[model samples]
Target: MRRGGAETETDDPTEDYDDTHADGEAVTEGAGARRARLRRGRRDSAWTRALESRRVRIGVAAGVVVALAVALVAYFSPLLSVRTVEVEGISAITDQQVQEALRVPEGRSMLRLDTDAMAQRVSELPKARSVRVQRVFPSTVRVTVEERTPVLYFEAPDGAHLIDSDSVEFAIEPAPIGVPKLVTEHPGGYDAVTRAAVTVMAAVPPALRLEVGQIAARSVSDIRLELRDGKTVLWGGATDSERKAAVVVPLLGQPGEVFDISSPNLVTVK
Candidate 1:
């Protein structure tokens, strides 16, 4: 009985070994589960960092694309893609000539057209007294030209020189409409007497311009007129040209060989 009790108090070796093994296995399983969780957390962290990096890269790339698109639009916005030309105040010069002078072709960008160069080119034309060019936004260019008008015709070595009221000689061409020829002894002399004679003739009535065929300026103080109707006018000087012209109109009404209106206060007829 004593031996049996002592044996009972002693544990079974196989059972003890089985319990220790089971406990060790449980602890090992727990440690392994914790290691697996730690490894999964590390992998998740790596994946999250990679996703963030990818997002940043995508954002930068999108920004670059947007910036490029805006830059392209801004760069090409103001370029002139179409062209329109308009000419105004041109009489002696043709519109086609003015357009050719501008040298701007169709489909050329308006921003590229050199306005100063165009104005300079148009001014090269002999008949252009003044030239002005402007760009009307988007597609139009406007050109305005002031043409020279003939005030008197003088005989030149080559032909007749057309003179304006300002005494600027333009060309030796035929007289324009409504302009009178002033035949003078000093044909090429565009001196003060010629200018004064032109001033006097301009004051004459428009109806009488073509009637007076020749105006001879022998001297500044002596101006003679040869009428187309075989009559003569002995104009004394350039004094009171308007008054002298007014007096000549009434004298022309009457038939006479010579009508002298040299003195505005006194008149003589032959």
Candidate 2:
């Protein structure tokens, strides 16, 4: 092949074409491999994303289940049950009476207590004017009661009937001091004269009320007040009671045996 002094090319015309063809094939294969690698990379990334999303969903569902279980345990378990009942504002009615009325069983869950129903039950007691029942956390139920006050009292065959400012006959207990005695033909709310007497008594000021020993009503229009000092007052009726109450106070100083402020506009002291 190198017969001449200057190097002469070999007579292999297909060699250059073959080398070029092989190089082209190598480049095509490399490009195809690169494309395969890219596709694999994309598939791997998509699979990873799907796996992460599925894990998050599973985690959320598990958390919800755990929370619900905890809630159920808190709601029904005896760990948060009531062990004691605390009563407040109770004087007329004994704590044992109120507790009996409540009827809440031992070991009842605080969260499961029907507070409204309990309060309603306790209020059934005549002396309990208003009641509040609540759970005092882990182990106690609290009951707050506002007892009825005796504004006036009437004697009956059995005992004294106590009346409050609302004209309700609440109890038959002995009347407390400073409470006025009510006297009427028929001493009850059903009688108009009884209502009139209580209405007039309610209008009397606290200071003047202490001096009033007895209030009698013959009819709805004829109400009389007997003071502790053996003096009498013609209170007329339920009408203009506020004016009558205001006029009767100063009229007492006038050395009168009978004070007539029944018609406050035309008052007389005799």
Candidate 3:
């Protein structure tokens, strides 16, 4: 009993576990916190070093400056200059004519080329119905042209004047194939009968136009068509040209020497 004065070590398992577990958890948490601080310290030191160095800041700024300078040189210098002028969609006019109209200088920067001015210049060509001008990147300028197509032709003292759908006399050469001749007392652009005849011609389908030999108009209201054969068509005026053209084609197939479509809604064949 006298030995009780000295405290003896207990054999209980939970006591040893409780005491050691707390110490172990505390040690693990301290180590983890120290590791995280070390990582943050390393990152902050690297950032501070970079901020303190004038060369680093200058290097980034110089890189941005160099990139911008390169871009400026590429845009203004001859590196991205136009080296070729390309013309497309031409049958009556030559490429040389279009290129001359463009008049863009060689080695001119594509960015500096005025596309609208170029298109306007090309549109001055009588044969050009529509024109588009654009810069083909890196070395070329492209000119796209839509040439006027002749719907009819009229004989003049000089030559055969080709008339397009809009009554414009675009060219004065031999009439193209399948183009019907226009016969009017005054067969010029300003003539009312000629314009009526042209309107009738423009409304006729391509296949029907091929079968037609001549179109005659006395006044704006009196128009006629002479087929390749001896058949005749009495078409009315420019007002109902579209409907007359539509009715006359099917009426021609009927057994008749004359087809009258003056009133398209009431057609007659004789």
Candidate 4:
């Protein structure tokens, strides 16, 4: 047969089928190649995302470390510097005396101040029995002193002095307030009777303290009390001081020249 612009022969349907099959195979191979390229691109993008996440984490961690280091340095460095010193609870002893006792100068590092050593040194003062020291941050130091209360005033070879319960003496210019004077023939009485007198005085009511004029102890057993009214109390010894003081107070309430409460149950008055 003759077709338009061409001569036609018998068509081989099997050949045409083979050509169509070959074309389908070529299209399938092209599609597979395109899919492979897309898969490779996705893998590269995922690897880039992982690397970026790691870098961000590393940067954050580094920043945190730097901030911590700076904070630590700033916190400790200023604590080592001291700016001010404050003194409290000191009356008999001067502030200068306490400062001299502590031996810690101003502008010295707070960390370098030894609290234990300073406390020990402060205790060496005759009046100081207990001491405490504290350091406040950013450069302030506080020292507190607890002084021994004088129980009696004694006359020594040096001068008149105030004596504490421990028999330790401190020199006072005007003497102590609210403390009784002790007169004795022997100076040794100050050491022997000071403690006993403190106990007796404490046991006595506050109303009777000013009424007491003098305590005279010639010997340990021969202790006497002189009242403001010029009457003598023949307190024989230091034994049963609380009981004796208890009895003496009530007896003194009545008009009496002398009262003896040395015996536990007996009240002898003259």
Candidate 5:
């Protein structure tokens, strides 16, 4: 203890090594803690994404429900319901008659009303030549009908059938005053002779048709039109009826008992 007056303490080399090892361990622990924090953050992000996806699905479902509810409300609402039915373009059948025929489902929604079906039902009327049904927004249904016009009167065993220009026999009623009486052996549709006579009547001018008393067809080619005055026109067939009608008025000015304008090219007044 007295040899050199400062019998010193020995320097320990292991202390430095222990300190360095401790520092390295602390650094490694810090890095591990940081990695754990990063992993936790990743898990939090995945959870958040899943939650957001669930929310989107819920929102879409809610939107769909809302849309469906709106549609249903519109479908059943009184605003879209039919409150009145209007019948138009009808004369032979009154509006009341057409309404009775329609029997339109009152208080039903216009959205659900079948326009095509209503048109078909209205078309079943004998006098309806053409029909159109329209949906009037918010409370009305409009039905438009075209009434068939009788071009001639056809006598059948049952009664007098009013025939239209298209040779369609629409109704059985008394013969109209001005329309010509069509006489044929056959009563119904298969008669080409009746069809020819009707065609000729339709082609004749209205003024001239007023004077026509009767049309007789023994056969299709043997069609003849008799006037109210004691005169006759031998119309051979249904062909060139428009031309034949044009030839008639001017040819009638000549003194003639019979006008043969059937062959419009070679017309004869005798």
Candidate 6:
């Protein structure tokens, strides 16, 4: 490639290659060169080989299907159904009645039974204070009920209804043999004066309770008890009940028609 002057020399186009270098060696085209890094590692192990096998994949799928089939059979089959129900821990409500109240679904799987729902149904019985339902396994369900105990009886048009410690009117049966009637002028359940009378009756000793024929309360603070032997106790208010009961019992030993322990510290007798 001569230019415009006679003094210019032509350059060879293949002058960059060296004949002494082998073809395996790389020739750098730029000022800077870089080497690639290769990591040394072991071959794939048996665990990895097993994961990729067609037989292993098929076996896993079959296991999952069988497990699902077994679960469905157990949940829906009569073998796990409730064939028997037992009721316990009750006095007023009969065992048969408790079982009937439960009303658990017949032929239902024991494992799928909802104890809470069954207990709620049993709790509908007025006399049941607390209810518990348990799976007896295999094919049985057990219901345990705690019946409310009456502390006094409230007179109603139909009959006398029993009141428990929490002032709940549970049953309308005949008053228990020695249980006393409550007269509060306020006939409703848990009336202020009625609660006071209940408190007064509860504080009375068991011996005195047997002697109590009826309890009356004119107001929340003025309560009276008329005994079976025609004696009376003037027990005022729900407060200081324990002390007044203590005073009334020992003083009842002395001859008195009216045993006043309204003020326990200064008791009076008439």
Give the per-residue lDDT of model 4 (tens digit) for 163-229: 6666666555446666777776544324566656655656566777777777877766677778888
Query: Judged by lDDT against the true structure, how good is candidate 5?
Result: 0.82
TM-score of each: 0.61, 0.77, 0.74, 0.66, 0.74, 0.73
Per residue, candidate 5 scores C-alpha lDDT tens digits across 77-167 of: 6668878788888778878768777777766678888889888888888899889989878688889899999888877778899988778
The total number of steric clashes, by the backbone 3 Å criterion, in model 3 comes to: 0
lDDT of 2 by residue, 55-107 (tens): 99999999999999988888888888888889999988999999899998676
Which residue window of length 10 is worst by lDDT in model 4?
13-22
Of candidates 6 and 4, the better by lDDT: 6
Kindly indicate the candidate among 4 and 6 with the higher TM-score: 6
Using TM-score as the measure, which candidate wins? Answer: 2
Indicate the residue-level lDDT of 216 in model 5.
86
Q: Which ten residues in a row have the lowest lDDT in candidate 1?
A: 11-20
TM-score of 2: 0.77
Instruction: Report lDDT (Cα) of residue 152, candidate 6.
Output: 90
Q: Top model by lDDT, which number?
A: 2
Worst 10 residues of 3 by lDDT: 13-22
What digit string (tens of lDDT, one per residue) describes model 1 on residues 150-228?
8778876788888876667877788876576766666543587888776777676777777777787777778877878
Q: What are the RMSDs of all candidates, in order?
A: 17.8, 10.8, 7.6, 13.1, 11.9, 10.1
Between the candidate structures 1 and 6, which one is better when assessed by TM-score? 6
Which 10 residues in a row give candidate 2 its minimum summed lDDT? 13-22
Quick one: RMSD of model 2? Answer: 10.8
The lowest-lDDT stretch of 10 consecutive residues in candidate 5 is: 13-22
Candidate 3: tens digits of C-alpha lDDT, residues 83-116: 8888889988899889889888777678888899
Q: What is the lDDT of residue 160 in candidate 6?
A: 94
Sort by TM-score, top down from the best: 2, 3, 5, 6, 4, 1
